[model samples]
Target: MAPVRIAVVGLGKIARDQHLPAIAANPAFTLVATVSREGDGVPGVPHFQSLDQLLERGPAIDAAALCTPPQVRHELAAMALARGTHLFLEKPPGATLAEVAALQGMAQASGATLFASWHSRFAAGVAPARSWLAGRRIDRVQITWREDVRVWHPGQAWIWEPGGLGVFDPGINALSIATHILPQRFFLKSAVLEFPANRAAPIAADMHFCDTHGAPIHMDLDWRQTGPQTWDIVVETDAGRLTLSNGGAVLALPDRTERDEDREYAGLYAHFAALIRSGQCDVDVTPLQLVADAFLCGRRREVEAFED
Candidate 1:
């Protein structure tokens, strides 16, 4: 089959670092065009200021990968679906759960493939870990996701804004892996969200969770770590212990260790390509819903004002 003609919207760091490379490496996709305000697209592709212009005047496109902020994702996704273009959304599919549900409906109505890509869930170690834990009872879960915003996000002001999601932005990636590999689903039992004295979002979070089977879980997310970063999850089962670190690229136990190169975005685009070819949609909202639940029930605590 011919390569699926594709366009990437929002030419920011992620688009440049991950999406563009992934699309180029995957023969299943052809990066036909790009949408960025500067018209500063990849060397050989045409660039448009808006999706409307691309859909109206450019050559036909089979799919679009949206790397825009979650706040505006729903509108762009709806527009693409309406035009019968398959959609690939970055993690945290939409700013709100309701918007994602609506986008799911729009994709269905238009028969367009809608893939809410969770790059972390596609990490190399995640799938094998899930398979290893099959039918095992989880006794407890511990998650520690701490990173320095200055190093990773730099001057991303939106991260502290009302809809930016702050620490949960990176924390959700952990949730994606946890939800994907765990034997049972869990829900928030209590949460303490630590917001910077002046910001609208949390810079740190402490949460406790439980599953119907009485299994307990706890997570700590902090955006103020000064030096080495950490993204790790540990789950203890009836038989042994399992741990995944480095955002799910590394898996370890007391006796064995395994590591893999980060091919998350590459895997994500491949999955999107398959979905487009098969005329299917994958819209798993469990991770996003967990974020939503934290926002809904979390108790707020004001802390030292953060400036960056």
Candidate 2:
């Protein structure tokens, strides 16, 4: 099969650090063009100031990866899907569930592959953890995902905007893994979101959830951590304790441990290529749904203003 000609939209930090390298390494994909409103793009590849310009005048592409902020993803994704271009959406697929659903419908109508990618789910330990817990009786689950936003997001002002999702941006990664690994479906019970006095989005959240079989699930998410970052999940089951740390890159079972190099984005690109070839769409909104529930029932608390 020929390599899929692909364009990468949004020349942001993630696009530069993860997506570009993944595309370059995957023999199944060939870089064709790029789009960014700030006049940023790859050196040799065709660069467009907007997706409209890319579609109108840039090189033809079979697929596009949307790496822009969540607030503006819907319009960009819709344009590509309408043109029968396969799409790869970064985490927090859209600002809202309704928009993502609409895109899924568009993909179906156009016969284009729509992948709402959860990169964290592709972490090496995630698959193993899911397999190990499949048959065991889940007793309880705990998730702690804390990191310094200044380090990760830097001066990305869009993150604090209304549709940006604030800390849930990273928190949802944990949910993606949990939703995929757990044996039963889970729903949010209650939540408390802490908003910095000056920002439109919350800086931290404490949420409680429960699975169908009554297994209690607790989540603590914060963007204020300054020291070593933590992205860890601990689950207790009939067999024993299971731990997935380092953002699902390391797994610790009762008797053994497993760890591997990072390959989340690589795995995502591979899956996207497969979907495009098979004429299929992989749009799982479970993780995004969980984030929506957190905002719906969550009590809001105003805290000290955060300065970036």
- Top candidate on lDDT is 2
lDDT of 2 by residue, 65-84 (tens): 99999999999999999999
The 10-residue segment with the lowest total lDDT in model 2: 37-46
Q: lDDT of each prediction vs. the true structure?
A: 0.91, 0.95
Q: 1-308 in candidate 1: lDDT tens per residue?
A: 99999999998889999999999999999999999886489887988899999999987899999998888778888889999999999988989888989999999999999999899998888998998888988899999999999988888887788768999999999999989998888999999999988899999999999976899999999999988899999999987999999999999865788899999998998889889888999999998899889999999999999988
How does candidate 2 fare on TM-score?
A: 0.99
Overall local distance difference test of candidate 1: 0.91
Off by over 4 Å in 2: none
Supply candidate 1's per-residue lDDT for 88: 94
Q: Estimate the lDDT of model 2.
A: 0.95
Q: Candidate 1, which ten residues in sequence have the lowest lDDT sum?
A: 36-45
